[model samples]
Target chain A: MEKTINLTLKVWRQANATAKGAFESYEVKNISTDSSFLEMLDILNEQLINENKEPVAFDHDCREGICGMCSLYVNGRPHGPDDEVTTCQLHMRKFKDGETITIEPWRSAGFPVIKDLIVNRNAFDSIIAAGGYVSVGTGGVPDGNAMPIPKVDADEAMDAASCIGCGACVAACKNGSAMLFVSAKVSQLALLPQGKVEAARRAKNMVAKMDELGFGNCTNTGACEVECPKGVSIANIARLNREYLKAKCLD
Target chain B: MGTFFSSSIGKKFVMSLSGLFLVIFLLVHLSINALLLVPDGGEMFNNAAHFMALPLIKYGLQPVLFVGFIVHIFYATMLTSINNKARGSVKYAGGNNTKDVMWASKNMYVLGITVAAFMAVHLCDYWVPLQITGNVESTTLHGTEMHDTYALVNAAFSQCWRVALYVVGALGLSLHLTHGFWSAFQTLGASNSLWRKRWTVIGTIFAWVVGVSFSLIAILQHFFYQA
Candidate 1:
């Protein structure tokens, strides 16, 4: 059965990056339960447009949970309350009728608020730019099955590769640590043959950049894994520790 | 290597290694403490104390133990400060509100401070008198002239407030260890998905035993000791 509900939306508003932001309450009514959270926001924006008020601006692209763009700290959780899904994937049914949903941007020093419900996640790009890619020779096509990559390594690499760099791990982390994101990036590449040659250098450089960028250290609280939309594991963090230590110490 | 220790993972490695070392010392200390319950009139305990008082352990390893403890606390404070900075000055009106993180894992530094506070009391009641001040009365147990370390412990536990202090301290240490044990393994990269679960279960059991047993023995001595 289809359902529609009324909600009190507490949306954040800021004119620019330096402008102070605050939650401005507005009533969004008759929202379809099946509509995505973003669509519900679109309805609210239309209402705001009819009122001749500035619409709440939030980052969103490829609203199917892949673009890693839509981020909202809704009611104290990053990407809203729906489990293992982005804010765009969150359906209105997950919320109660007449519930006042508080939506804010990702709060972290590494991710500063740009506007209402939008923060700069370019720090992640900086860490990736440091050493997140595998160097390729780029010549003739290599034969498949020649290197004989282990199945476990390939699978684990793929799992780590699922990270979308959305900064949810950072948003959800108590310390604002980027360990999960960096570890996922590091683990995905380090597990594969193409990335192994530069693994040591990658670990050292990436970690250096992460710390340099003012991210906190991991204390293994496991909060990052819990709130991650990608379901990325903290085991990659342990792997990163192993990689970094091997590069810095015994290697 | 000079500058590598300043990295985030490097700091964690230091914290875990220092913590694991203290974990070893806990076992040794607990084993000796168990001797307090032997009921042989402190003979075996005094002998063990005398052996522990031997120059090598008393002088050599004692300093190392202190260093390990200091390193753990120092780096923890430094890291927490850095983490606070990383968290920024912005207070999220909506809190993290996460229930998945273990209580001990989140409150490790606070628990560590509690344990350290207890250690100050502990050193005053036992270590200071026995090891440094030489104020504990001497006794010849089974023809062995020793520092009457058993008497120092027994007399202390005999007091109601003293036993209560120990109970609090032991429980604090226990909470600290529950997270520290498995977390140290994770930091050292010795744990995975399967092993992490195994380590967490093992660590919880180990924490309860080590913590509550101290309370048990303290209660026992406070109520049951004679002479």
Candidate 2:
């Protein structure tokens, strides 16, 4: 059975980064229940284009959850009402027929809106550029088990590695803190034996860059953990704090 | 050091360190104040208060404690403003509830301001006259002359409104500590799962003990010990 939902979307419309933004209402009719949230936006854009009106501009690359490019503050959450899923994974079934969904950009000093619902997340890229990489030279492909690692450590590292840098943590945080994102990157490298060579430098440099980017301090509110689509834990934040403090003491 | 202190995490580290120091101070303060319950006509209380007033502590530790309080307040105000600005002008218009975060965690600033306001009243009642002016009516205790600090405390707590104020202050401290105790250790690098879980348990108990103990002294003095 094909089910459809008619939603009234109060989408934030901003022409440019410097322009004043406000919520503009549009009615999206006959949206399929199985359509992803982005797909619904696509339908609305198609309607606007057919009517010779300017379409809403949003950022999306792979349309898959892995890309971290699909950024939307659907309703109150970073990725709509769904848990442990990105906006691309959030289907229309989550909404009621007459629901009025509110959408906004990621509101943070580090992430200014480039246009309608499109935020400049280059701050994250800069932070990653700081020290998010291992210092190993490129050569022949190393053996998978060249470095022996405990299963617990490997699993923990993988968990930390799951962060997609979507900026959802900042969006969810009341303080707009990027600790969860920074901590995920820090912990992923800090936990693995291969990345352990420059763990201290990585921790210090990444934290410095994060601070330089004007992100707020973490107060351990744990909102970042709950609203995270990738299920990134604030435990990684604890590890980042540990790593940073250890590095500072040594310095 | 200046650059480090200016950083976001560095600011937080300052807050955590100062908060833990104040927590320790509270424990000592509570124990000293608990002497009010002693039924020896303020003899033991006065003597203990007199020792605390000795020059070594009166000049040395008092200044350090005051600086700790100032630093904590300074950094707290600075961080709160910066964090508020970092959230940007466009506020989240939707509902603001998350399952994992505590209410106290979100409202620590308000709790801190409440506690600070109470401290002003408390200092005016006791610290100013006793520490700064040394005008706290002297009395002899254990064959030595000491400020009748016990009388000051007993007289203050005897008033129902003053007892109510202390209770409110204790409540604010309890809420502040509930998130802060474990959070301080976490910021200081206690990140392991086992230790984090343990700290959460320990932090809650610590908050409860401090709050209940401080409030008990006030309530007890108000109803039972009117001397």
Model 2, span A6-29: residue lDDT tens: 999999999999999898999999
lDDT of 1 by residue, A68-170 (tens): 9999998888888878899999999999998989898998889988888889999999999999997766356678767788899899899999999899889
lDDT of 2: 0.89
lDDT of 1 at A5: 94
DockQ of each: 0.76, 0.66
Candidate 2, residue B216: lDDT: 96
lDDT by residue (tens digit), candidate 2, B14-105? 99999999999999998888888888878888888899989999899988999999999999899999899888878987766556688999
Model 1 CAPRI rating = medium
- Flag regions of model 1 displaced more than 4 Å: A138-141
Lowest summed lDDT over 10 consecutive residues: which window, candidate 2 chain A? Answer: A137-146
Highest DockQ: which candidate? 1
Which runs in model 2 stand beyond 4 Å of their true positions? A138-145
Give TM per candidate. Answer: 0.97, 0.96
How far out, in Å, is residue B65 in model 2? 0.6
DockQ of 2: 0.66
* Cand 2, B chain, TM: 0.96
Each candidate's interface RMSD (Å, one decimal) is 1.1, 1.3
